[model samples]
Target: MSASKIAIGCMHLLAKLPLPLLRGLGKVVGRVLFVVAGQRRRIALRNFELCFPDVPEVQRKAWAKESFEVFCQTFLDRSWLWFGSEELVRSRVKLVGATHELKGDTPTIVFAPHFYSMDAGGLALPLNTEREFTSIFATNPDPDLDRWFMNGRQRFGNVKMLNRADGVKPIIQCLRKGGLLYLLPDMDYGKNDSVFVPFFAVQDTATIPSLSRFARLGKAKVVALYNRMTPEGYVAELTPAWENFPTDDHVADTARMNRELQAAIMTMVPQYYWVHKRFKTRPDGEPSLYSGK
Candidate 1:
């Protein structure tokens, strides 16, 4: 079966558990991964070492480990928070703007970082407000566990899943209808399609197509939305940017937009910088943050 089918099924079953139970389960999974999974540990460590070169090696390593642990804990907590107590999820999040919606033939774009609990980020938006949008999602890592999780996302009133195979039509149609659409332009889908952009002054092969394609095709308002972490609740901010999006030169424009994306994401939550491979695919002839004594 297709990925959308599996994700849709697995997550549904997981959600059936009590919220507390899910939280516990997630904690257990995180702890196990931290202790047993060395590859991701290595990735996190390497990424951090590069991102924060000025910090002492020891300090960077320590923060990366702690960040990984936190990442795992948040992963579990988010699922529990989203499925069990919708209010708690909403409580932690504060929405900034509302002028754009999936109302008619005008599409609105929402950019969220894979920084926080992406699952929680998904729910927080639609659940917090009575607004609606068709959010795009990458295929699940585990095909066997797809169904239930995908369904959980769909539980929110607004999100319409845009699978990798057939995202174009639905996305455009949704935007044309004045609906909101979400996508993450961080991961590299293909080098041929990507542009090397400066993320923290380090060039990364980032996703430029999503924004470029949307900007090229749709006349919708392109808004940069980011969720900032705070002591109390998340500060979700919205800022409107160039719409035609400098479609003149695909590579340069894409790179510029990516740099802008990095700036916006950093502003959202400075702590998120502790964990991602934000500068993974750097430009040739440039020394990588991953390199050090």
Candidate 2:
């Protein structure tokens, strides 16, 4: 075989090694990423401070370390989760409080944040009797690479995927047909596309306005769900929408709901907070998050 081909084959073999050794090596790589490379640490550090302004720097660092641990567990066990049999996955994950409020024949919209093992919910699909997931996906390149992702996730019983650009129409159609569509409401989209919501009293951004607009226009049931890691594995909880939930002022309502969700996120998942560049698109005149307070 060619030299490059042999090198690539060797890497593949290493990736398939025993879980313990693979996990150990993964830690080494993560250290390289966090300490040496500092890829997302800047934002992680910034966010930790923003969220815990009163806490000491030492305690903030503790939370940051815990976030790394959670991420490590999720990343190392990735292959096992994707390829493991249905029984194995079902046994690991359990859903609680998936009440009737979560179900109904309407365009149901569920806002699921990126918990440490949030995607593990995909494995718990067939195991669920209450609802089937039809995902709204942000498309990426590489069909062959993404095939395994689809195989693990797209169970095809009632589950579906939508390319991000064309996601709106399908989601609206699903609502009209009385189906469920999931969206990640926490991530920033762009200027005017999202608004600065008071998350932890800081101007954190979110995309739930799209959800609010969808709900307002389609009158879909807006549900909040989270997949949190438990000692056994993970559990999905359906937090019913507030009584007389916002229907009039969508932008304002979206911001209010995101604040409520952020509180839930802090309580359930202190770590694996899906630390992202939340303040990158700050409004004009706002202090840059990168600068030290």
Candidate 3:
């Protein structure tokens, strides 16, 4: 069998295990990653250095370690999310806020940050609610993995996953039709449709202007969604929609998004995805953040 197939088969078996057992295994996997995943560990540490400089080194190290464990648990949980029964998955998820009561009339954009279990929250929405959710899915390099992701994300059959390269036309149209868009706006997608914004007090952070633009064009209401790992299970919370969003100033709106993201990250310091090179694309003539070994 191909590597992807073997992975899928393993995950299928893993999915049958109890949540606590899977999480215990994930903790072991995380400890190994903390020592061996050198580059990613460095990046996570760098992120903490930049974002939480006030935090003590020992505390930051502990946070980074926990972050790895949470990330691994979320990673492993995908199998249960993708291949498990609807009742099994739904039982493991607890809805914390007004996501249960949201009406599908107004165009809704659920702004998801880079939490490890963000996909769990996305999966829950379409499975529980009757609304159709649409989101942009970036194609994976591995063909098999890409197919798996596409199939898993749309398993509930109420979602429309568009390729990221397909541009924003489809997303805007979907939102205009009053569908839910699970928009993840925290990545550094370069300078084309993005602008440098202050993320966690870092001025060189690259942020896309699409979130604000989509809200205006589709007449969408923006709400924050957080999926967190608790002792019982994953808790997915949806804040009420923001007021006076997507004003005439796009940059200000993007800044507002980042500010909210910072606040949200504060609530659950670990579990936010920190392995990415967020500050890689520096401004004109600026030195790189991850330069030294």
Best by TM-score: 3
1 or 2, which is superior by lDDT?
Answer: 2
lDDT of 1 by residue, 176-226 (tens): 767777777766455555666665534455555667677556666666666
**RMSD, candidate 1, Å:** 5.0
> Residue by residue across 1-293, what tens digits does model 2's lDDT show?
55544543444565455556756665566556667536567677788787679989987777776666567666655555665556656766776675566555766777677777767765554456446567777654655446556765664346777777784776777667777767676766667677667766476554547767777666777777777766566787777766555568777887767776777777754445546766666777776776642
Candidate 1 Cα errors over 4 Å, as ranges:
1-32, 97-105, 128-132, 141-144, 204-206, 228-235, 241-247, 264-293
Superior candidate under TM-score, 2 versus 3: 3
User: Cα RMSD (Å) per model?
Assistant: 5.0, 3.8, 1.2
Model 3: runs farther than 4 Å from truth?
A: none
Q: Estimate the TM-score for candidate 1.
A: 0.73
**Best first by TM-score, ranked:** 3, 2, 1
Any runs in candidate 2 off by more than 4 Å, and if so which? 1-32, 130-132, 204-208, 291-293
TM-score list, all predictions: 0.73, 0.84, 0.97
- What lDDT does the true structure give each of the candidates? 0.60, 0.66, 0.86
